[model samples]
Target: MKIALCVKQVPDTSDIKWTENNTMQREGVESIINPYDIYAIEAALKFKKNYNAEVTVFTMGPLQAVDMLKNIIALGIDRGVVISDRKFAGADTYATGITLSAAIKKELPDFDIILCGQFAIDGDTGQTGPCIANLLNIPQLTFIKDISEYNENSITASRFLDDGIELVKVKCPALLCMLKSDFEPSRALINGIIKAQNSDIKILTFEDLGLNPEDVGLKGSPTYVSKAFRPDIKHSGEKHYCLENNSGAQIIYDKMKEIGVFNG
Candidate 1:
């Protein structure tokens, strides 16, 4: 079986830079793999261990992301591909989904399954995975927390919902957006490090992916960030303490009435 692991390089939130147009400037920022994507990698690795599946990690980022791909390859993925291009700059989640889907469709047409993190920390929109599935015209399950069974044709897994969890079975050629799991990611050993350094990570550009510049980047993005700024700290909220439960309840009631939470 062949598994496609879709991953991403996200900027460190603590140290962020923005472009003049309110978009993130990622070229020179320090980056790390999305934490949720670690679960996706673990899933692909599990498939490899149990079924001898071939796992390829795919990511979209700037040229520097090549090192990030190497990092993933060090985690036992069979292959790695970095989709990078200057033309792909300033792409929103929608455009990014298009570029990644096009790359996967053309390269891994026979892939049995695609795995991705539920969302990237940088954007946190949680839309890219579903977007890719829609563009590829395949079934997608988001917030998948566990895979109970896997075979050549289908998989049974647990999906997390706001209300509760649901079990689902999906056929091959499906996409799964995975949530973080309890599985601890394995550390890279010396062999993995050596292999990673020697491995040939393939690079795909916009032209290589047969994409038009206008179809990607800001041009294809239907959404725009008009402004981004931290809300001013008007004042710190006050905290109240009551010695008794009844007193606390009474205080809360009075405050609610004062704030118009209670009518009349």
Candidate 2:
């Protein structure tokens, strides 16, 4: 079985700085692999160990994102691919999915599964994984909590749902978005770290992915952020105290009354 793990580089939550354009300042901002992606990688690593399959970590971002790939390689993945170029900047979920789909189609064949984190920390949109699956026209399951029961031709797992949980089954060559905390990520072995430091990853440019200028980046994005601002913090609210033996409901009612909820 062959597995592909899609990971992303995000600004370290601890140290965040903004650019003049209000976008995250990547230059010098400490970065780490997306936490959710770690879970996906760990899942892939488990499969690789049990089945002796090839594990490839794939990422797309600025040149600095190569660091993230190095971090993954240290975990003993077979190889890594860095899809980086200036033209890929400002790509929204739609364009990102399109580009990744194209890359997967062009670079890989005979892969049995694709895995990704639930969402990128920086974006928090939780859209890219499903978007990639949609672009590939493959079956997908998100928020997967387990995969040990998975098989070569199909998989059975539980997904997160608003009401509670949902059990899902999907055929192979499918995509999954996993919650990072679902499994504990492994640390890099000493030997693996040394190998990773010297591993040669295939660095792909925009052209390598067969993407045109019009098909990626901000121009390719359908949505745009018109404005962004930090909302003023407001911390004033009405508090009610119990009168005599009044119940909690009565206190809430009195507070609402004071706020004129009873008034027409």
Best by lDDT: 1
* Candidate number achieving the greatest TM-score relative to the actual structure: 1
Error of 2 at 102 (Å): 1.4
**Residues 9-87, candidate 1, lDDT per residue (tens digit)?**
8878878877766676777887898999999998998889888999988988887888988888888889888898888
In model 1, the worst 10-residue window by lDDT is: 237-246
Error of 2 at 83 (Å): 0.6
Q: Cα deviation of 193 in candidate 1 (Å)?
A: 1.1
lDDT of 2 by residue, 26-122 (tens): 6788778998898888888888887787988888888777777887889978888888888888999998887777777766767888899998888
**Per-candidate TM-score against the hidden true structure:** 0.85, 0.85
Clashing residue pairs in all predictions, respectively, total 0, 0
After aligning candidate 1 to the native by TM-score, how far in Å is the CA of 222 from where it should be?
Answer: 1.2
104, model 1: CA deviation in Å? 0.6
